[model samples]
Target chain A: MSFKVRQEIATCGGKLLKLSHFSELIGLSMDVNVYLPKQYYSKDYEKVIPTVYYLSGLTCSPDNASEKAFWQFQADKYGFGMVFPDTSPRGDSVPDDPEKSWDFGIAASFYVNATKKPYDKHYMMYDYIHKELPVLLDEHFSESSTKKLDFLDNVGITGHSMGGYGALTGFLKNYDANRYKSCSAFAPIVNPSSVPWGQKAFKGYLSDDENDWDKYDPCKLIKRITNTRNDMILIHQGTKDPFLKDNLKTDLLTEASKNTSWEGKIDIRYADGYDHSYFFVSTFVPDHARFHAKNLGLI
Target chain B: MSFKVRQEIATCGGKLLKLSHFSELIGLSMDVNVYLPKQYYSKDYEKVIPTVYYLSGLTCSPDNASEKAFWQFQADKYGFGMVFPDTSPRGDSVPDDPEKSWDFGIAASFYVNATKKPYDKHYMMYDYIHKELPVLLDEHFSESSTKKLDFLDNVGITGHSMGGYGALTGFLKNYDANRYKSCSAFAPIVNPSSVPWGQKAFKGYLSDDENDWDKYDPCKLIKRITNTRNDMILIHQGTKDPFLKDNLKTDLLTEASKNTSWEGKIDIRYADGYDHSYFFVSTFVPDHARFHAKNLGLI
Candidate 1:
């Protein structure tokens, strides 16, 4: 459960600690970046810092969101920490896509527990992220600092694109337990089981069966899970995003929520002229931060 | 004098226009990115917008600073435009370092007009940046928009690393004429003539002669140029920056300014434990933005 500190960088009234630790669930070493906001360093700060887990999109590392998301400024303002987990497990031993494609291999885990051969050995990200990482983080941070951090229960979850889908699925799957207090996404693939990128990943990592794919899909999870707390899911999708029409059909999420307990609880804001890059993500990060801050009871 | 817009990305309450145009002095196509603030699009706004030119460091295109500087947010906040100019001319015909070292060739023009053989053909960045590019930008932006932009006259200058040296040299040399209304730097190489990076660039671009090198060195320029307006140059240097010991000795500028009119006017703030990366630059960008905003009469 102990993490090795790689680089602790001073940035934006806080420190970004780049850490590497062995994952007992995935059976691989993983890198994660945790930003401890300015309040964390304050001696008088008595409250346990609640974290927002930010998952990155395909073909990304922890560094992408840590560098470009521009979340530190907002985190400092709201007194919240941020966790940026790697998109997938990576190493020479780790099996990659046979086609050498970016979407289904090393940096494209899709946050799924693989049921297929070769991939089943290392692609247990779904279990690692939700079940194990948070508990391990809660323990490590508590032992490391006098001021505690609530990574397990009092946390929020958000991501971009594929990670966005992961966030929605995770938040909905654990909705009954209230694992995450807040949920949001930036250009997420809401209904992953129907999309080409998701289909390919599912076939490669799981199986060809739609029944197996439906288990991890956000659209299916929305109908299965009952929202008892009258919670909201915040999302921002850019109109000019190239992947909007094909892979990320944001409207399908609203359609899936209709006649269900989650109907009208999805706040999806379509930003005009914005694309699916970090530029778009950073622009609306302030808004998302406010949403998460409110749910986490910071504001 | 005309610019071709390669890409216009909507980022934070503004549009980042990646433009390309032929430089008359350098005799090559140069890339520059201009960020137009949200105020520019306002229909009823009457005031002419002022620009702040941000020169990038070595081994970087116009896109590096445009993507990472986080200047768009500040530009939108202050209602001022930002111009990110390339460091050097590029192409197959352009002469690079014989050894292909990243510091003294291709992207390392030192923002100086080369006086040597093949480099002289294309490495005329000094004249292009401080003299030609601004006028061309003024002409192009004025013709394109209903609300004019003051790119040439009422503009500020700033940069990082090698470009930091560029900012200091340009601001001091043009102080008498007040070419740049404001100036600032992040981890700048102050005494370029004394440093190894500056020595190699000066020898390669200018000549072996110390007198030629002195003309472009900020240490020398401060003594030569009189600070008649009692203007101050704000500079931020990271204490943990790797180059601080050698290439970027921030105190040398202060040492050179003593007994001169520039004494006590070079406000260099040494920030603790910040590195020479965009992380450090972006952290201090808010401070620099406020400084430029006030100087440009935007605040």
Candidate 2:
């Protein structure tokens, strides 16, 4: 698959390349934004630049976080590249929510591989993000250079809201294989199987079996996975977030980790008076960048 | 002149107060956003907080800069409050562009008092922004407090594109009166009298008298104003900005300053690979904040 450059925007100490490519897995074109840090453009830089993938929340395209999250500055500060993948596949062939709801349709793929009819044809976001996209990026961006940009290894993952759930699930699911070196989130949905937004998405994309939903739920995965290293999952939740009460029950993840290897390793910081908006995400991005940088060995 | 609190959003150790109030000067309700830094909320804060006024470019509301410019973090870092004033008067009664174009009427007031028919009725933005807004904000916000917020004295002014022109004109025209302590611009049209955008706006708002436009034009004002304080106006112009060659001839300001008291005082820093967007503005906000902080005696 070849990546097409849509726009190259200069921001902070680097360039944000808006790219689109045809995905054989999804059978449709997908959009993703990649931010190359200042270090990559430096004359003396020789080391391979690590990447930090940011998954956005509900009803968002790649542009939302790419435009507003203020990640470019942090990426430059930490000398790390950034990858912002789209939430779902979008095209005429892509099946939308029957009811035309925002939380269940085109923008809300939940980062899960679909097993149901219609959706199964194209909604393979889990494979697209976690597997295909990384390999493709590594191949495409490293073609002309002796120094490489690491996309798979020595990479960290972070997200917000639904994408937060995606990051945690992906990180924990592939922990044994050592997939993501670091993981963090801003107001993520920790217990997705128990939340309304996740329940609707799970039912729409996955099979009717409840066991299918449990595999993708972070709360359930944390209970089973044993942390071999002294690894930590950083998370920030706003006390004033409207979804905290109903959907993003962050405490459940901590409670589920009790007596498990992740008991004290889940650092969930409760921010005061913040909400479920980019204002909240951008505020905590610097801290997340530092955490990811340390894990990726950039700091 | 009471302000209605539309929304109070917590952002980066500050609160962005979205307020709407009736403006007697413009004969319409205006929306404005004021950010109170963390210093304002500190129990030990005794010093009166200074403010920096940010004016947005064409086709913008107060929310544009409040949401995208990433200024809240800088305001908190420098311990300064921020004021984002609306560009023009708006209502059903207000006249719009005859061609329904975005550059004229409605959002495009060009920060000038209209002297022509139809627009003259409510398009008195010059008085509304520079004269009335500060007094109204001071009166309303200081009513219940012993410590005052300095909206009038010890304040800085900066803007983007058209608003950049506004900042330069305002700073130079009121230099003798000591209206603003500091001034800066991002990709500003330095010589509006010689530009097409300026010509259209000036013709539509002011009468056929070219002398009326000369008063508001920064190039003309820079030649006449005496910079006795050795004050320097900081400006950042992106080299890749599409409007640089056309509407925004930044070099004209420097040329006009030559042989005058303000020669070499107009510091225009040409940023590489940047454009005319919030991405460009947000990148340079920290620099502007520090500049203003120094001038406002906060540093």
Candidate 3:
């Protein structure tokens, strides 16, 4: 990862640092924000905390997750590291869909392997989160010191919307059994096959083959979890979420888990009067932090 | 305020409600996210809690603070209201400075009464916080209910950078002594007279007469306070802030409070290797919340 340390400022608590990293991995130079807990530099150098990688939904960058999620308090108190990466690659010349839509082109990069002609080159978010980012995060920040390559000292993953799907499947698929112990999501698109966002992005990013689409779907992937991580997966969904009925199939996941080993392991909470936005996610983020903290044994 | 209630989602043991409130005051349709505590609709409607209004710095809107500050957990546990307002009035015709500087145009409203010609119409943020917005908040949100307001229910104002200045002065000047109680800031522009941001904003928003600047200046306002409201004021500043020298005058406010009734009442915490941003604010927001909770007798 050939990246430039754009700006590093000492925040009121920890360090608010930004880095511009570019690679052939993703077409654009991603801006990443790392919030190293106060304990990062404290006398407890040997003390390593579990890291949480937050992927923003669409049209967001590292700055969005860093600014919007309000996770630092939990990170600092819970003693965890947070890594935020841009949702999709960006630049003027990059090829985009002929039609303009919020879901495709700029803001939306389905966390899948884009097999389509135009987007296939740079839409490699799966690798960015799974392989490349871990290396990049370890190299630049203090969390790099905790790079034991073991899931216990190293990591956990979570995100909202598309990013949450990434977090759900990314941690499920990527981490060595030793490195990833827990995963959670906030209002994630569960059955992407049924959701408009997922269907559109999937069709554009992948071939017509439904098998390829299954690989990226969390609902489909949850069915394939051979062994559970920890005991349960925590998911908070809003009952009033505009897209919940059409897009986020919390019920489908609930039913699927009920019939599988994942039964009693999927904790699906139906939050009332909420929507598909960060405000819903931000409200419950600390709970996610606490959830991870408890299960990860960080607390 | 003709606001379209878009979506209200409840989660994180609370409620996340989004609304599109059009401020004839700002001539812009603003997106605001309000977090209602779990007990908001409980049987105990009379239960009062302290509310903290977080003002975003330049180039930020209400959306930024709600997205980033990461305050909900504490707000949920401690039971306080958080009100986030957009930085400046925005609209197509709203005059922006010819120079698209981050500090001057969209993000930076200076929070003072803008005396400049174009900004004069919509830049009435001073009134928005003190008068119009409060009425709207009380009308829509439970915390703003009359019983809660009667207790002089603890009202603490806090913010980062320019918003910090707004929090400081807003509390000092227009604060309903009978209602709002505590005041704190994170890396505020204490004495705008000394900082470039202060000089530019003061000149644009106020009269050329330097004496008038004292009205909005926190250091100057400190000397104006004859009786301390709650016990003291809390300020957390980053020593390594990039704009520490140019934008913030911590020493001036520190010295000013030292000579007044606030002498021992001012709690100034200087954190090492931090800067003027939300990362810094989030690191210490819990302490500030605890400070208000204690002063409000919520512990």
The candidate that wins on lDDT is 1
Question: Candidate 1 on B1-299: residue-level lDDT in tens?
Answer: 39999988988988999999999899989999999998898887778899998989999899888878899999888889999999999999899999999998899999999999889999999999999999899889778877888998889999999999999899988999889999999999999888899888998888888899999999999999755786789999889999999899999999999999889999999899899989899999999999999998887
Name the top DockQ candidate. 1
Candidate 2 segments exceeding 4 Å error: none
* Fold similarity of candidate 1's chain A to the true chain A, as a TM-score: 0.99
Alpha carbon lDDT of each predicted model: 0.92, 0.92, 0.74
- Per-residue CA lDDT of model 3 for A1-299, tens digit only, reads 35577887564345556878775588677777777766675765466656788888877778776776667767777777777877777788666767988788666887676789899988887887777777765665435454332223457788887887788778656433534667889888877887888899998888989999888876777677676444677888877777777877778877766676677877888776777777777777878999877766777
* Shift of residue B103 alpha carbon in model 1, Å: 0.6
| Segments of candidate 1 deviating more than 4 angstroms | none
In Å, residue B85's CA in model 3 sits off its true spot by 4.1
Real contacts retained, model 3: 0.76
Q: Report the candidate with higher DockQ, 1 versus 3.
A: 1
Clashing pairs in 1: none
> Arrange candidates by TM-score, highest first: which order?
1, 2, 3
Error at A106, model 1, angstroms? 1.1
Better of 1 and 2 by DockQ: 1
Question: TM-score, chain B only, every model?
Answer: 0.98, 0.98, 0.90
For A1-299, candidate 2 gives per-residue lDDT tens digits of 38999989888888899999989899999999999988888888888899999999989999889888999999999899999999999988889999989898699999999999889999999999999999999999878556678998999999999999999989999998899999999999998888899899999999989899999999899877765788999999999999999999999999998988898999999999998989889889999999999999988
